[model samples]
Target: MRRLIIFALFALASIMAPIANAQWQEAYNNSGAFNGFHFTDSLNGWFSHIGSQKIIHTSDGGNTFDVQLNVALPFNMYDVYMEDNLNGWACGTNTGSGPGYIYRTTNGGADWIQQTHPASQSHWIQIEQVGSSIWFIGSQSVTPNNLLIMKTSDNGSTWDLTSYSQFDASWLFIFDSLNFIVYADEGLLALTTDGGNSWISTTLPSDYQVQRVSFKDNNLGYALVANIWSN
Candidate 1:
């Protein structure tokens, strides 16, 4: 009984021991809302702020945020992609008719160059990288035919218009590097098997607006929905 009691006490102490915690410091604080955060690990990450016309980057986690660039485009960055501690990309939408922009950084967030996109500057809503390339989707209701899909192989140097769909502000995710799936407004869904070259739209009878979507792999996915109808 005494031996069992001592063992129990040792187990309890081990369970109650404090874990080694790493401290997170406020790396940067701009005068706007930070829309998205992407980090591969605690040492490297990127944050986008829309109202401030800036993207904050940290090579050593959130301990420091340096303004990589000041494009100050008319859009608010909603999402960011960091391929490594150095390579990163950002995509967001503009407020007015100004088209959105996709910016890339190669020198560890020291500077960013905007990709010369064919469509209007205010179109891209969300952007992410799937392997060595980056993909984005843009919407234009007035143009009716301006719903565009773009891909960049050389980081953000240039973009190729790959597909067109009448979807607005769609959320895109890539699985297995080239396979992708997008869920747009009005229950419109799309799947891409060859990078972003072609897409097939699927029907989803959902009354809620899907704000974000993530996939653990090709088989399992989780989506966060807002503006849902309870009735």
Candidate 2:
């Protein structure tokens, strides 16, 4: 019986070892603070720094990184998204009371030009690419009390802004040009299927703050909350 118990324990340990090792591991370490990162594939990826105006790109799957597009100070890079190796966008603020800015790189970050938009006059937080549409999630001011979602189909030449007043959105996930989800700190979850023209709001039980949300499909999704509640 002793031998049987030890064998059972070893089998269970073997079964659980793969699950424990599947968590996130440190791939690369740098001196600057990375606010957001996205990879087009395993070979190409980019990361933006919070305090600096530069972005780091790795071509060989993070084995090496090269700094590109160094703008002046006071313009922090918050989020970066690359549609491909050549076309990419980065969004951030210009310090003080200045509006947020979006920079685009066509030749793989060799040159980044600030794209002009009406929403660029606000504090942008995140940028996402959905098909041919580009979405910008941010606030109207630097303090970021008012949440806004701006979409541009013509690649930042024109923008349509959708403002939310009830809940302060923390993060957003775009499923497509028409469907997306936005979650807030106070258990607020909003869904939009007809683009940002309409939104359905749902509140989860308890005061659990929502951190992030993801959907496997249009019907199945999950939300990450800060705390768990008991019955």
Candidate 3:
């Protein structure tokens, strides 16, 4: 009986080892103070690092990263969205003002142009794309008090704002051309099945300022939060 139990325990341990390894293998850790991240394929992905003042591009499935470009200002890139390698957008704060700025690149970050400056900007929290439609959401300021979302179909040329006053948070997320989700800290989490024309908000548990969210596919995703305490 003792030998049988030992054999059963060994078999269980062998089965559990691979499950633990698979979970770790699926996760990717950003090296620096990361504000935004995106993965186009299993092999190609990008992450924005504030401490490094550059974006890290990984073509070998997040195994290794190559520093792509270092911006003149080491501002925090709060959100990143790319339709493909050649066309992408990075949204974040500028030297001054709370309004976030949008930076566009056509040649895969070799050259970037300031596409839009927020005359009435906020802290951009998230960026996402569905087909040719792109969406961005943020607070009226960095306080995460007033949540707002902007939708554009013709790239970033024009935008339509949808306001949410009840929620004290905002975030941008897209799973595919058919599914997009947004969560505001003010107890609002929404989903859009038909691109960005319309949205549906559902109940959520907490609004404690979720910082980062990642998705491997439409079914699997995770949200990361940091704990803060005041003395």
Candidate 4:
């Protein structure tokens, strides 16, 4: 009886293995190159493409995607963030020779309006939101060595720019309106506890480049580092 029970358990495990290892089904196919995708829930999702001027949306868990916004070309959407089904933002470069843009969609990506900035810029790679304020971080082509950090308090109506003397700013992580962190090119990390008025800097091992930094809260955080190969 003991041997029979063990054989039964093994047979049951074999039957359940296929269901656990099921493959992901292809949901949508398009000619444009897809760059970024975001899903707020199981049923609602959005995706951005590089060559296309429109953003795709799906209401049925990606079974079918519809063209949600038909903005002009050259604004290749690089990243998208949605607070919910209704409020969201997308960022990308102009592909021509002008500054990039931050677009906001309040009605579930059906319509997007470009937000005004303090100056013409290049690319905005990341966006963070705290309450009603939004923050953007990206590089500017002032001399091929300029990095910029911009913030908007009235939901992208206006922006303010901050620069760090030749350091290439790559990522922005916001803990709140008063505190945030930025990762730079040369293993440099900047922390601000009293808003953007001042900052404290710390340098890690010079050989490793900081790629990304994230914080779970004010006290706990993690940094991803990559080794810089030298000639």
Number of the top lDDT candidate: 2
lDDT of 1 by residue, 86-159 (tens): 77777776676655667777777787777667766446666666667677766652445355677778765676
Instruction: Estimate, for each residue in 62-120, the C-alpha lDDT of model 2 and write its tens digit.
Output: 78889887777687788998889998888887766547888888998888888877754
Better of 1 and 2 by lDDT: 2
lDDT of each: 0.65, 0.75, 0.65, 0.73
Among the numbered candidates, top TM-score falls to: 2
Output the lDDT of residue 190, model 1: 76
Cα lDDT tens digits for candidate 4, 39-100: 99999998887678667899999788899776666577777788899999888777654577
| TM-score-best of 1 and 3 | 1
Q: Give candidate 3 regions above 4 Å deviation.
A: 1-19, 22-31, 62-64, 94-96, 117-119, 142-144, 172-231
Quality of model 4 by C-alpha lDDT:
0.73
Estimate, for each residue in 1-231, the C-alpha lDDT of model 3 and write its tens digit. Answer: 111112123344665776774644543454568867887778878777776567777888877778776767736777666678888888776545466767777877677677664337566657767566777777666454566776678766788776566555566676776576665443445777885567776554443444545665776665544333344
Question: How high a TM-score does candidate 2 get?
Answer: 0.79
Per-residue lDDT, model 1, residue 88, is 75
Q: Candidates sorted by lDDT, descending order?
A: 2, 4, 1, 3
Model 2 residue 134 lDDT?
83
